[model samples]
Target chain A: MIIALTVLLTVTGFFFFFATTIGLIRFPDFYSRMHAAGKGDTLSSLLMLLGLAIYSLHHFSFGNFLVSLKIIFIMVFIFLASPTATHAIIDAGFESGVKPWTKEEERAEE
Target chain B: MHFIYMFLIMFGFWIVLSGKFDAFHITLGVISCLIVSFLSLDLFFHETKKKGRIAEVVRFLSYIPWLVKEIVLATIHVAFIALRPNVKDNIDPKVIMFKTRLKKDLSKVTFANSITLTPGTITIKVSDDEFYVHALTKKTAEGLPGEMEERVGKVFKEFGE
Candidate 1:
């Protein structure tokens, strides 16, 4: 049961990572690409970590339990850190005078 | 009181991360946590006209699940748009500038972080009460500010424009 669940979550995480890769290549602008990277990166890793944490507890030992808790701790830290990092990147883009892509500019550029 | 609470929390995290219970390691954990708590007292708690302390913290935590759900939904939305062959038609990138109702810096930062957490919307700049957001689609941008502002405001207990 645990194996099945872990495989499912790992696959889902990879699928999101795949989508992020596609978005990075296909998206028209830097901001849109950041969207893909930020959300995909955070959620995929979160799911993968959650699945790993749950699977780690399948044997039901004290050491395994502590390991699971540490995985969760990492998840929580990532939850807070990932978005802040995204905002910092966006702020950097703004500070450097990068205008966000508009419909007309999309056509005008190339 | 707050200092001790912060230290305890930090030390707990240290235990989880370090995975060691020996006397020397434990002493190092205590010393480091104490130093951190002292150095960054203001980082732990936001001092406002504190109200319904326990209730407010509970409410804010409750909002977290809803935010996670939103993040998942938005990720799926972005994923579809990214995966579809006609990606150009799918995305309408634009910057939205608006003022939020959140009063405190903590609330403002939280709101901005939440925006970035959700896919397709990245908060670019914040000044005073104003937020500049870069959104991947017009649909995502249209109905965002009002609902999110109200929700974050509830957490901070400031409920107006």
Candidate 2:
């Protein structure tokens, strides 16, 4: 059960990660790509971590549970931190005057 | 006191990991914990704050689970939106203003970070009476100073002032 679930999660995580990478490369603008990087990528990674946590419980002991809890704890920390980092990047971009793409900007010479 | 506290905490953690109460492992745990904590004293030596102490550590631990749930929910929401067929048509970006009641900087930053972690919100700038948030959806924008502010305010004891 653990092995199957781990494989499932690994596959789904890779799918989302590939989507994120593709979205970054193919999106029309920075803001759109930022949306991709900031939103789904974090969740993709967490899903992968969750599967790992469940697999870790196969050991079926207090110590394994603690290790699982520690992973969850780190997930919580990353949950708090990643978006803040994304916001910081956006804030920096805006401060440096990166404007959002208007329809006109989208059409000009593309 | 420091040595004892360190020994107790780390040894407890070691026992949790080793699943053993045997004397040999217990002694090893104590020694390891003491060494790490003693070295970590170098970190504490430069600190000057009095308000932040053991109580804050306890508070933060209590705060973790709720934050994780919020992150998961936010992540799901963002993923759904991103995968939608007509996502950009739904985008309604704007800046908003709201008041926060939290007194401490750390708690204030936590609140802001939570907003940022959510699907469509980013805290662009913050001041005492106003927080300027850049939101990607009108609905999200409308909920500024939403329940989150209240919850975070409660954590910082910023209620009803």
Candidate 3:
């Protein structure tokens, strides 16, 4: 049962992940694209990790618990690091003077 | 009292790494923990008040999920911006200075770090109640001091501010 739940969550997470990836491709402006990617990646990783933790509990052993703890640790680290990385990238773009998308502006740029 | 807590943490880590409960290993764990803890006494001394430190640590731990959610949202935002071929070209980067009401050093730092962690903002500098942030877009610049201030304020409360 736990395995099934895990698979379901992982699948759902991947769906969002790829959707954001596509949004990065299709969105007409930087800000809108960022809106999709930032929210999508965070949710997907979190859901996937929670699913793995749930699956780990079914085995209920010392080693398995420790492994699960390690996974949690990684998730926590990513939780901290991912935002910092994103901010850095955005800062770089801003420093370079990139302009945001607008309706009329988008039509002209394309 | 302080040594006891350090000993427990180190011993737990030792057991986790060594996967042994033998007498010799246990003895080695004690010695190693003592050595490390003794060397780290400066940290304990700096945090002289013990009554609230543990609670503060617990509070910070609980805040991790919220922090993670924020990060994930920010990442998705940036990736979408970066990958859009046509949209990627129009980024208007500008710096804005704002006044913050947060007083404590730690809270101010947390506020700055959190702002810089989000996709479109970078904390350029912070001084007491003032912060200079560089935003990738006007929207992000406008959102500054809204939700970010509230979260950082809560973190300050954790530290007994």
List, for all models, the DockQ compared with the true complex.
0.80, 0.32, 0.20
Interface CA RMSD of each prediction in angstroms? 1.3, 3.7, 5.9
Residues B13-33 of candidate 1 have per-residue lDDT tens digits of 898778879999999999999
For each prediction in turn, the share of the native Cα contacts (below 8 Å between chains A and B) that it retains comes to 0.86, 0.24, 0.20
Q: Candidate 1 chain B, which ten residues in sequence have the lowest lDDT sum?
A: B43-52
Taking the tens digit of each residue's C-alpha lDDT, what string does model 3 give over B51-73?
76677667667766777677666
List where candidate 2 sits over 4 angstroms from the true fold.
A4-19, A22-32, A59-77, A102-110, B1-69, B127-130
Q: Is the docking of candidate 2 incorrect, acceptable, medium or high quality?
A: acceptable
TM-score per candidate: 0.90, 0.68, 0.67
Among the numbered candidates, top TM-score falls to 1
Shift of residue A36 alpha carbon in model 2, Å: 3.0
Q: Rank the candidates by TM-score, best first.
A: 1, 2, 3
- Residue-level error in angstroms, candidate 2, position B80: 3.1
In candidate 3, stretches whose alpha carbon ends up further than 4 angstroms from where it belongs are: A8-53, A80-110, B50-69, B82-85, B124-130, B158-161
Query: Can you tell me which runs of candidate 1 are displaced by over 4 Å?
Result: A108-110, B35-51
